[model samples]
Target: MQTSLNHYSQNNEIHKDIPGRKEIIGYGLGDFGYVLIWTLVASFLTYFYTDVAGIAAGAVGTLMLFVRLWDGVSDIGMGILVDRTNSKHGKARPYLIWMPIPLAITTVFLFTVPDVGMTGKITYAAITYSLFILLYTAVSIPFKTLLGMMTQEQHTRSMIGIVGAFFIQSSALLVNMITEPMASGIGGQLGWVMTGTLFGVLAVVTLYITFRTTKERVGFVPTAKQEEKVKLSSGVKALFKNKYWMIITLFCISYYTLLGFVGAELYFAKYILGNASYFSIISLVKAVPGILAIFFMAPIVKKIGKRNMVLIGILSIILSTFIKYLDPTSLNYFLIGSAFNGFGKGIFGAMLYALINDTVEYGEWKSKVRTGGLVNSAASFGMKVGTGLGTAIVGWLLAFGGYVGNLSQQSDTALQMILYLNIHIPFLIAIIMFLLMWLYKLDKIYPQIVEELQRRKNE
Candidate 1:
């Protein structure tokens, strides 16, 4: 290990290779696979559990809250595992190669509701969802950590994020456009089973490409002694001490909490808007603005800085969502609000991974220990908590409002609750995110941090 460190120090020049367009596109392709699975589960899973699989709303919500809580715990464990790993394939990229097939399998199982009774079905949901979250954490933590490992240039990382957003939103749009129609056309449980299988296959292929094409630099290979000293407690301590990381983690939790509104859209469209297929239209509307936002994201972040860009984006969401709340039933108002919300989401989404990557650097600079996996894992932990809580809110709110999945049309109380979950709740969360952004000042100090790290490395 000492020899390895000396070699790395002596050959610091070897780390300067910039990723070409092919590599960048390859990296972006990984997210295409990732979001295909993620968007499907995040956006559609709750609806599938209740409306399709015949689970009660409250049960589904409670199940998700517990599963996601376990998922959060596993995320931290996966992070530490990645940090401790020293393999020929590199620290993070190996998981991309190994886990895709299992991820695909679990995805299929998640959608394949059995012919068992309610107890059986709930058990199936728990078992399958747990496995899926485990596999997802295994792959996702590594994939996210890859950003920091791939390059040290902030601009390059930002560009990778931009390209990635294009693929992520594009995959999400495709899923939105196709998932419902395919499921409905196929007639029952088999429809969802088929949809999951198709996306799962695609996920495997794209992830393999990512594993093959991307290379990891800035790799931290710990000595046995160093590894022995790297306790989970220490990693957790390092994470909390970094103010920037704490701020970003909070931002992620809030941002994703607002994003929980996506889970409610299928119900909103089916019950409130009176057309399940309208989800495709709303998704299209949202995707276009997000794609457009990607085009301007890098430049805007470079100009006003990440914090300011995020502020602008969150404010856009709050404003548009508020407008939608005033008149929730109007088609034009819904579309218009969705467009602005998508635009804002696109900008913030593009900046977010890059900002998190910055936090890894900030953490290392502050703590003198480079644990990219733990830092990114901490961020992912927050996101999982947000996702679980957000989904729970939607579930519990629907149950409280007398949502009955088997009914042709919901009661007025249920529709009103759907409206709140769809528009107003997220609007409030966006305001909280805006407040969180004010505490993040890393963008102002990042350059100095980089230069100092470089100086220390050379010395």
Candidate 2:
């Protein structure tokens, strides 16, 4: 028989209440709220810093480095803080209520490049960027932790991943579609600020619905002797040593980096595609599979196994990316290649969190310690680091290319470098990521881990 099947275990010890379907959907919006601002930043912020705001690319990149560095350190602290929390709504959910205001303020101002001289501009960028990272930490830690309590069953967790992925990708599509054309018509600063504000408000409603309606069920229960002494440091240390977790951390870093690396297409869509409307068209093509993937993605994982699905995705990305590299000027080749890339990304993105939930269970099974907050935060920290690094590299490379936006005249070499940065880098990174993931051992081994956990519960 399947030794890892928890299909028969009693619900009480594992969890209290089954999270409602409504709660699952609503909580998704909250998670999406965090990502909406992030998507906006990713889609337009580099263009904003160098083009509209008139900031130097090198300096903007430096500011990003500091912000992500802060993000990395804060994740450790937030993980600890979550462990110490003891609210009625549960440990991780409380921060959802506390984080929205700071996120809104910092994000709005981050877009507002002041008329400071070079010195003032640098100072403005530094302060705003730092605040953005801190607030992002404050919001995202709580938001990611919600997945821990959403479902105890493996299948149920996978379903949540599907829903959440749809929202995140859909938002990304909208951001990519709007950023340039809107900027062209309304101009830069207002275009980004208005878009950010509108999306931020929408995200707030989603998060609030999640907060007011969601329930926490699967929390760590401390034993009598250990009840009072469960400190954050303990959780942090336990998370670091986890083997399954080690694989996950590496996976997230690679996966997020791969995605950001693809973001170079924003520039390609802007300049080489010959118009901003092509961005929306390409994004729509990309998003269609993303929409459909959510419904079938979970079942695909169940049938093929998670590791195999990841392998398939990695291969698809590699092939599509390389194809784009080989035939850069043909729209037919590019469109087909991009569709495959998007389809593969859609599959993987919708499913990575499901893999994370499995890792959390594996960690609990092997280590006899629970650290959901630590688990989520560490992964998120890796994502933020990747995002910051990706954007910074884009900015720095643009500076190197000497590509000046809205120029009455353009240099041939500078334009060429911009195209190269837009297309070539993402293609190369996606290839490297495929090879790295080929080394992943966790998903194939997870069924064995699941069997062990069920046996312990059954016995």
Candidate 3:
């Protein structure tokens, strides 16, 4: 049972805090649009660089590493900016409206290869990809920050996160299903350009819906005297002091690094499995199980808490990673392993943002400062850093394994390297994530934190 729409404020003050069907659907669509373009970059961009755009593997790896690292650092700056912003649309929601058009434009530019020589190619990629990531930070940090403002109830936030995750994975699955064949059938760079354009258009529309439907209801409003004293720097210092935020940030890094390995899975499907179409099958197996898992988690999450659910998911990931090795050549084993992996990722996708939002209350309770943007932004920084590192590592490893693009057959070393990425590395990451989740005891004390914050608000 959850509480009603009327929520409490300072001195037992009451306000209507509404996050109903419209809000949930609008919120989910935001991520659904985000992942449409995000999946294109995460799963296929590296492949596009090496195979279609004619960049060397090492160059692509180095390029992604630097750009993504900078992108992560930029998130902190964006967070700070978001905290300071005041508008009719509220702090975070305005960004949902302001940034998506440029974001959509950059999405197309990322897949477009300029007709130039090798050096020129690398330079072009660097510029466009950097712009893409920066714009992503601009929109994404603000969108995530809105989660805390929409409502104070943990269960409602979790439900929003769950619906958002469903859309995230569903969009990823859609991209995987269509991207290769669509690009292949259309032929040449034109194919990718058209696909990127379609996703970019969709991104602009869905995010606008989010901006229109959601409202900021739970942000902390300071007294006149307190407002004069509050500094952004102090809020940042508070975030670092937050032990729970640190733990979850690390967890994000590990989880996304595991996602980075996904780039190599295409190579595995192509050379090792000897079937390009297996990539689609693999995507199907992975996504369907994860999507299904999301439906069942809400009830369990309500009872046992998000931390426990994540622990269970990590264990599933670990088991799935090992299962792939049982008979590496068997497609059945890969499909089964993918099923387990997707289920775990589904749980993670549903819960990670909600958990980050929880830390906002924790931070305010501990440090007496509420930083919705900074908190979400810093955590998002960890995610992008992990994504950058993961994607870069894939490029580095593939190069080390003597991989070449558009080859009829890759070397035995390349095959071995791909296998290690798909199986060994992810297993180790799952173990690391599991340990981090074990350290998270926040769910047990979150109520006390909330109660205390409310009591303080009465002062």
Index of the highest-TM-score prediction: 3
lDDT of 3 by residue, 1-459 (tens): 123212233343222455877788799999999889988899999999998898999889989889989998899999988888878888899998899999999999998988799999999999999999999999999999998888777777778888888899999999998999999899999999999999999999999999998988876355653465348779878998999999999999999888887888888888888888799999999999889987777788888999999999999999998899998888899999999998999989889999999999999888988888899999998998899889888889889989899898998888888898899989999999999999999999987787787677676
Off by over 4 Å in 2: 1-16, 220-226, 229-233, 408-412, 444-459
Residue 314 miss distance in model 3 (angstroms): 0.6
lDDT of 1 at 215: 89
RMSD of 2: 3.8
lDDT of 1 at 78: 92
lDDT of 1: 0.86
Name the lDDT value of residue 43 in candidate 2: 65
Worst 10 residues of 1 by lDDT: 1-10
Against the unseen true structure, what C-alpha lDDT does each candidate score? Answer: 0.86, 0.70, 0.87
Model with the higher lDDT, candidate 2 or 3: 3
The residue pairs found clashing in candidate 1 are none
lDDT of 1 by residue, 338-381 (tens): 99988888877678888998998888789776788999998999
